[model samples]
Target chain A: MKKDVPYFDKVHRWGRIWTLLALVALFSVPLVFSLAHDAWPEPGPFLKGLVAILPLYWVSGIIETFTYTPMIGAGGTYLSFVTGNIANLKLPCAIAALEKADVKGTSDEGEVISTIAIASSAITTTVIIAAGVLLFSIPVQWLTKSPVFAPAFQQIFPAMFGALMASYLRKHWKTAAATVLIGCIVVFFSPSIGIGILIVVTIVAAVLTSFLFYKISTKKSAAK
Target chain B: MDFKSNWLMYLLAAGVIGFVVVESLFFLVKAWKRGKELGISKQTLVNTVTNSAIYSVAPAISILATVFVLANALGNVLPWIRLSVIGNLQYETVAATSILSELGGSLTEEVTDPAKFAAVAWGMTIGCCLPLILVPIFCKKIHKKVGDVVNKSSSASALADVVAAAAFIGIIAAFVSKSINGIEVTKTLTGENVVSSRAGFLSIATLIVSIVVYLLLDTLATKKHLVKFSNFVMPIAMFTGMGAAVLMTQLLPQSLVLWSWPWLPPVQ
Candidate 1:
């Protein structure tokens, strides 16, 4: 027997219309805000920049939406992809199964586990982001009047980025080394090359090094 | 002065927490009803929803905590650097405040003396994090429903499968809206005295466009290559976004610091 299509798919008139309207309304929000605002200064360059960033945000959203489910449901994906799959041999499938609700050993138990996992993740994310936005941004303004405190605090972004990147680098030694080397060599000379160029170039360098390593490893095996 | 004055932020957080509790209860109820219909014990449904809700939020919390640490730290650091760069830069404060206002609600500057700016800062940070807190809760509800369907049938129907996908998209749209609104309000209302409000508008517009272009190129390149390699690009997209955000913050680096500091608390 053929699989039956879902009721939701079968053109529920109200839901379809509402979803469509929501899409349209949401898409128009930024546009409407843009039009209503006064003539922006040197609007050309700035508007260009905002336009440039929109797709990145959009894509980030798309990736984020999917990535969380998988990650929460399955622990091993990160384990295998990040580390060289040492101790976490069974985890990737387990986590994936958990998220996809295809848990092994028992079907009933698996469904319960996966469903709860997704719900809790959603709740947690919403709460933290909202709280973070309010709690952190406020003190930022108060410090502006202070002479000593304000400047001391400003290094957070670079520091955080540095810390995050550092952890990743520590995990993958050669690629990280090569990326830093390339970034520093190029960006040091051309400070104006901007962060985007620095990132793109560094990622390319890392990928190249990975390729070279792969080639070397295969050749060594063949020689053996 | 009173808690009532700050009730909005509290209310927002409370609403989110409430949603999680209520949603979990609703799922449990549905699960029980379904189980009864299928002749399973109500206890099974309760156990299932309770377990599912708890498990789902753990990772979401982890990710949120990571973001909070980064964002709050950034908020703290931005102002100091911005001030150091442009010392006593006469009342760029208005520009900064306007930007904050454009982003969402106006700075409580007028009501709270600029001397108490720190307190106001605290308030805004709490308020801004409300959405981050709320959206994830909804994710769990959707997850539970999906779990139900999957349990009843051997596999999830396409529609059920897509609910998470759809909800995730909605969350993204909400985020973008929040960001854009912030920029426009900051530029239009708060920064009005400095230059044309349009300046902020136009500049943010350009920045957004650039990010989109960069992402498109990055995504297309990923699609053409090894699947694993392509997947790696998602984090790169986030990295690019941070780079873009940092760049924008640089424009009025002080404003970026002021508003963002609370969001990026120190991780360790």
Candidate 2:
């Protein structure tokens, strides 16, 4: 909402196709090579390794967008709308690139933040892909002795996810605590119910927390 | 049928279990209080959670199940079936990762290629992130609908509103956790150590550094003695903390990042 922030019209005007193309161009680097070097001694192992890591890369991209944005500005406003959108859109890699180039746009802060956000995204993306390969793909390769690929890909999704959740909990400790406590209790008692317990617990916790907040606020008003 | 990999499945199952229970309680409490305050029947709250969870989750679950089934079918029939459904995108991902690992390894590896590695790495750049990107667009609609529901309430709508939002979130969490047990399960298995030890170390280091940084920034923001700038500290701290995860990823090797490994009974 900042006056200096670039209008959404200008930034998003390129459309989703542009976003997709950017993403494709970003991802196609290796595919082109694989095609060119078709006989590169069983692309399976390498390909499998990459697939195993897809989850990590994906999650990191999201996290990087989050990291780079000044989501919490002085008065709870984002520094720049462009940076905010990229962060919200969960597309930090491209955001970072846009920043690096200092793409022409509205607002000095938006440009600055976007640049930082993009750089941050690029760095995190690299880390995510690397970690996925090492943790998921490498071990699988070592064990399977085949390009059959290890379930490392699965690992990537969870690692990024769990880390993200953990961070969220850290941010809103009270909500997280409530969520976890209720979740554990239900699971402990009704072991066979699968996710039903979560539904019950979540409802219970949220209502209770809200009620508590209301009570506190009313009490303060009374005193005033 | 393979037991070795079954550990992963068991891990997933347990996670769904936890995710469901906790999420349920959160929503139930939220809806119950809100409904009561609004003079609506308690059942309405329960129904809201149940209905929302079922509505949003079923499709994604089916899609996942179908994918799994299809994979198995192809794998069984082909035996050596390497379905090139998505082209050779795999090679690019691996090559990119290897190159990144090498690049992050240190400055010594100069002969290494950059463009090839960048391309390969780019394959995974958006992995599970596609959902995050998509979810917001969808969530906006849900938020608006819920806002309308809450706004219809006659009493202290603020409190009722929070409860309603919380209920929606709970329902969504329950449904998503069930549909995507894989994420939670992996976390649980890896979490025992990751949360307690690895995250612990990182958290501590971050806390200390954040305090120092806070103090330094505090001088700048408070130099004029206005509490206005001082409020920036929390956001700054939050931004820094969020960024720190990526920073650690950059600094540590992949193996070192996953330093948590708590022991649990083997899944039968």
Candidate 3:
């Protein structure tokens, strides 16, 4: 709490340091594993794999960073990107925490809440995965693959997004509904459309829908 | 060299996981302090943490399912480290398969050769390393620009909220649409790519069940003023919806829809 420096500035400074540390830590895993095993990669196949995948991976990476950083706030972005599971886990957790705290993403309070929420989610996921690896690898693997628990696990996306849609749509039906309709139409026709384009299309529609609703409400009030 | 579940590999995985856990704790405590400084109540922050943890449970289990699949060929330590850190199930499989295929091996086959195993590890790491390198460089500038737009006007702020809500709706629509259109090629967490038939009806049913349960919870918690019910809304809704999925599979005709995702095996 440096009284002189703005909170955002402090957060950025801390975020950058931690992010760099994370990078070092992550890169070292492969580096050290290769060293310890006395097994360096064969460059021919490695580069071939890299060539096949890096282009698309980098493109999605750039897109996600540009789109998701601001939405989740700074600290949350730093942690979520490192922890992985953005769309499925961190983003939703941060959004729910924001809604619960009743703070806008742009607010200072919102930044803290999003950070706390994301950090908590990351830690919990880490611990759970660690435990799964350590204790019950055999049982957990069998259980997840079991027919009875399989469907429940398979529907995680629906279970999550459905709850989110119900909450957001109930509040902003006009905007959310229009966006969902357009998204469904496009996605149904071509289910392979990347999420990047879907988000761009829906954002444009949602903003326009909101503007249209405001105009209609204003005209009605003026007439009255 | 046997690359499967060696002590050294387990130690390395634990080290990476441990480092990340500490990083998360650092952020958590720092942000918790920052919230106090910003005049938020301790109770609210605690509740947010609690709720976020609860919200993460189901998805975390699903992630573990992915780990299991990857571990089949690559061994436990590699998949554990990859998925725990930055390698998502999708990207990890794609990267691993790319390298394995390039090496004239398949994901179903284990890498008895340590050099090939190390190559696969490098493939997974480097493919997903872009954001790790790029975010720290560019995120601050992006965040500031967004804040400028958000703080520009009252109307702008309102639009920003719409933007966030739209993200949610858009993704849900994409997911549910996959189910509705009913001919999606989905990658199971088990690393199998298969064409799903009648999954649309099942997903749509689950989505609707989730929505209805959420509505019921909302009505009870908010309008009916059952304040205690508020905290459990998300977890409760998600679990019930999942339960409904299993039930729908049992009740629906097997010809039309069965509890047959991983059960249907692979059409690919």
Candidate 4:
């Protein structure tokens, strides 16, 4: 079957429009606040604040854009970037959906499934957070204070990733093993390594290793 | 005007969150229709939606907890709005605290001054907004490059799959390692050594349980030919792992304290 070139092009067009508008809308919050309160941030402290986080977050953001965009596909990329929480929520959800549907990220079916999954996850997260905020008194208190539930909340990342890793490894054991070995070495030896930097390095290493392995195996098969 | 926890601030927050919801709904409808046109069954699409929704709850609640922490520092509405939009728990907390400390104020205290509050709101908004702008500008280019490489031949397409799998596995491994290895030791006032990494241990335990649960469920689903069960397995494994973590915490020794990241919301 031929690719849906026009459909993807349309998605990119609409994605650009929505995200640019989102950028404007997001900045407007602080702008409107300053105007309404008749108060602008002091130049010194504001610059100081920006300088502190700008370097790290900017680099991380740039790295993430390159690393995640291809994996998430066109529609999923657009929506996940806007809604945020890429690593924690949207990425995992999208990957699980793709895996369940048995679709490759490079395929048209993969693109559609990823988009649907990410959109649904974003909507669900927004509604849940909104409800949690609006009904904060009892829910927040219980969530934070209930001793029985505290560990569950604390261990959330591990639990979510564990399930995801199992499924992923079952399909791609060689790549998963190599990645985990590198990850373990970095994490164990230098505990202070930043998570963002760790992710970038591991990805580079995994891709290089996988490509080499694929080349050698293909060469052997051809020789045979 | 009082800037701390004002009704006007809440109204502003509500407006931003409303825009996000509308935008998400627009994309959701578009994607759903596209999937239908592509011959994906309605049941599959609905299952994706349901699965994603269920998968989102635990993480959403975690984000909500961070909102409560930020509410204590920056007031209710700003954190509410910040988190509802492009902000995550770790980045916002770190940004707010860093900005607050720069101004000689702490995030543990409320920001009553409008100027300081604006500084924080702007600092967070701008610092995190880079990706939103960059993604739109460069996502198409990146996608095009990937598509070109993958479309070359069958071998190239398989290589691209390997690359994607590698990236995902590498990222997941980093996270898992961090959870397991993020340990610390501190001395008490009485000079007793306290191994303060119960949280890490709990997470390790959770990871084990989740993996086991997922494998068992996956096997059962395959045997029974239950496609829906496969779709729902992630959330189920997560919940089971979380339940096990809770049990471990209750039964674990007191000397081993469960330490959260410094930026995480404090247990109140």
Each candidate: what lDDT? 0.33, 0.33, 0.78, 0.80
* Model 1 chain B poorest 10 in a row by lDDT: B81-90
Per-residue lDDT of candidate 1, residues A24-57 (tens digit) = 3322322232233321223343334334333433
**All candidates in order of lDDT, best leading:** 4, 3, 2, 1
Better of 1 and 4 by TM-score: 4
Best-fitting candidate, measured by lDDT? Answer: 4
Candidates arranged by TM-score, highest first:
3, 4, 2, 1
Query: Candidate 3 on A1-224: residue-level lDDT in tens?
Result: 73798778877888889888878877787788788878888888779878998987888888888777877878898888889988778988887788777787778898999999999999999998989988988888887878878788888777887877777767777766677777677765666565555665665666677667767876898999
lDDT: worst 10-residue window of model 2 chain B: B76-85
Off by over 4 Å in 2: A1-18, A35-211, A219-224, B1-129, B132-209, B212-223, B226-268
- What TM-score number comes out for model 1? 0.31
- How many angstroms is residue B251 displaced in model 2 relative to the true structure, after the best TM-score fit? 23
Q: Is the docking of candidate 1 incorrect, acceptable, medium or high quality?
A: incorrect
Q: Which ten residues in a row have the lowest lDDT in candidate 3 chain A?
A: A188-197
Worst 10 residues of 4 chain B by lDDT: B184-193
True contacts kept of 3: 0.66
User: How many residue pairs clash in each candidate at the backbone level?
Assistant: 116, 44, 1, 0
lDDT tens string, model 2, B1-268?
4321234323422332233233224323432443354454444333333322322121112212222222221111111111111112222223333433433421122212333332333333334225334432332343334445546765645655446434433433333232222112212211121211112233333443443455566566657774444434433443454345446645767566444323312222
Over the stretch A1-224, how does candidate 4's per-residue lDDT look in tens digits? 97657988989998999899888878988898898888787889778878988996798899989888988879999888888888878989988888888888778888888888888888888887788877764677587668888878878878998998889878777877777777767766666566677878788878887787788888999999
